[model samples]
Target: MVATAESVAAAPGWFTEAIAELPEHREVESAGGAIHLRCWGRTGTPGVVLVHGGSAHSGWWDHIAPLLATTHRVVALDLSGHGDSVVRSEYPIEGWADEVMAAAAAGGIAGRPYIVGHSMGGRVAAVVGARHRESVAGLIIIDSPFQEPSGESIVRQLRRTPKAHPTRNDICARFRTVPEQSVLLPYVARHVAEESVRDTGEGWVWKFDPDMLRKRLEQGRIPPLGSLRGVAAPVLYIRCERGLVTPERAREIAALFERPATVVELSAAGHHPMMDQPLPLVATLRTALAQWESR
Candidate 1:
């Protein structure tokens, strides 16, 4: 459904108020592009880096970042080929991890930062927690899939294409979730749908490159995320009640954590908890971060 004037106006009061508190925008230079970071909160406090899922951008964190900013230097960056960032010749999990670190450093966020990522972003955070353990104090993976999909599903994902339209409204009209769910709150869905589009000169198009799904096609390999034993930091595995990750899978993934990995679920939330249940997600994150601050 398209986010019309009325729908945008219908955004939850708390959500509108949160986004009104603006953050500083900074440009981070990564390997092949200029990554965009929206930073909020005090400079000397502990740092938090937020990564969005495939085809998503920092805008996904708009209403949620401000809450965390109160106690930490929180920043969310638009990965390459998404949002305002330029597309690279190629994208890799390492490249995305590099962008997150680069953005954090450029924003003057000190300390081994806490990394929070959703979906594909979750995988990126996992990589950081494992490979760059010294750079992060902990990681929170939100509904990231741990199991590989069937070969047919992977092929279908790569071959899919976006439907182009003559106007922004036309595209937004058809906006829907990747793995469609019917229970998403209207205001939340409206906001996300509106943010996912861009006004190109010819017309409007999705903010992400459809080819991002072609990771297996281009690289001929999925990121080798073997055992979760390499991660040196605390882990909080949160799954949305209606998200893509199944409860059984959540247990399996959490089981791999060498250190105790706490798993929690948000009620009334789907794949995108930040959109459907922002407040609950914030509270959970706050509790975890508070411990880090006190330590």
Candidate 2:
């Protein structure tokens, strides 16, 4: 069962309309292989690079990017091993940190664009802020939790059956969030979900490589406390009220930063705010980026 054009009808008008503004694609070279990035807005304007969470691609930001593109040059990327980007033997957080720089440099995003990241991407942004402290304008981390890497999941080692669906309907039916949100806006969810798979003639499979999980698990590296304190740029930390981040944990994450981050909360959203709450998410980014730029 494949989702038809009729399904896109159910999505919000903003999303349907935003797709009309096409993006410029860039294939950035990294140590692993060519990294893919999508850009919108004029070439020389201040750049804002948006990074998606684990198991998701840049398409997750499609609707939101166009809105920000009006004010600043906006770009989103398929980090290595995810989306159409080249696969790696093993995934490293540092490699991803470098990939962000590579994409920005290749895209001609002028002068250390505002680095914004969500979930796992948030952790990667932290590494960028620390690793390239002076190079970045500022670091904005969205709803990324700090879990002890030592408590890594056992599921990564065990192999699970790869599920391929013959149609978009089959893929959409199987779609589920990592933190398992109880509710998903069908249109919003469908749009992101549609990009998550590729046609394999016989069926469609997820774009991300499973090996990325195995390799990341093998490395077992999450940004350490030192990286957090080393960040040179001003920080903006946004969390969702209903996301996996608990109030206590959010406070703890805030305490890790050397400079205080302007924290914002998205009410009634989950880990994947861009997918489910693009409007509020865009508004938060716009407001925070404005305040940062003014400084």
Candidate 3:
């Protein structure tokens, strides 16, 4: 079920409170037929857009977006097929990139903007930067596996695993079991769980289309490494030491960039470094931004 404003407002006490804390914004329309985005940040400030990984929405950045908004006009979006965005039964990774570009354009981010993405979003960001180099100021990838996604890979196979939920109550119960399944902020986890379901006659049910996983698996592949060579802006890759994206593999991928790319290994973090260690992640981002501005 599509998320209604009333439903969002009537969500659990903690989630409702969390939603209240977010800043107000004008909704920017996109041609992709998705919900117009609610944006934050000051006008004319250097733009920075955050893209989330698969099965997640813009809420994933609930913890980090506010922090980044202080410096740059940060914009985190719910890519099509996730969150409040329109549900497309068949969506491809490239289509996700196109939606981001369209959203950025509608938000008046005309020139190169700092683009940061996680997991699948990281891959989309790379494709955007490579294909639209003139519009990308810098690229920041967080814990995204740069290796090819194959049918045999653990993640790919897991996507194919059929999850059984007989009722809405069952779905909610399953969610409760993994309340802290992610390393993102607690509020983010709450938002994800809250937005993930719809109150049906029987109980709560998943809002996202299950086919999304299969589409992702079928279309998700390692983008051509050579494509990154077209990106003129410097790149910074923040990788979690024990995350899905290994340090050695990150270095190897970074080497493929035509320009030298900086890689920072977060020793005590996992896939969601921003949530696992916010301060360090923020500091690293600040340093990278400063370095890029200096150059």
User: Which pairs clash (backbone N, Cα, C closer than 3 Å) in model 3?
Assistant: 168-204
* Higher-ranked by TM-score: 1 or 3: 1
Global lDDT of each model? 0.82, 0.82, 0.67
Best by lDDT: 1
Q: Identify the superior model by lDDT, candidate 2 or candidate 3.
A: 2
**Residue range 1-295, candidate 1, lDDT tens digits:** 4456786788778888888888899998888578988899998678899999878888888889998988789999998989888777677777788888888898768788899999989988888787787788889999998756667888777677766689866787787776677665566666677778988777888898777656434455465665668888999999898999888888888878788678899888888787668899999899988876687
lDDT of 1 at 146: 70
For model 3 the local lDDT of residue 164 reads: 49
* TM-score of each candidate structure, all chains considered together: 0.92, 0.92, 0.78
Name model 3 segments beyond 4 Å from true. Answer: 1-20, 25-31, 108-110, 152-173, 176-188, 200-202, 217-226
The regions of model 2 sitting more than 4 angstroms off are 1-7, 148-152, 219-226
Q: Where's the lowest-lDDT run of ten residues in candidate 3?
A: 176-185
- By summed lDDT, the worst window of 10 consecutive residues in model 2 runs over 149-158
lDDT string for model 3 (1-295, tens) is 2234455445456344435558434344444466435455665677778898876767666656666666667777777777667777667666777777776765555366888888878888888787777878999888888666554673655556435466654564455311132454444444556656766565455655556755555345433444677778788988877578766788877876789678888777767665457667777777787788787
When superposed on Cα atoms, how far off is each prediction in RMSD? 2.0, 2.4, 5.8
Residue 99 miss distance in model 3 (angstroms): 1.5
Give the TM-score (vs. native) of candidate 2: 0.92
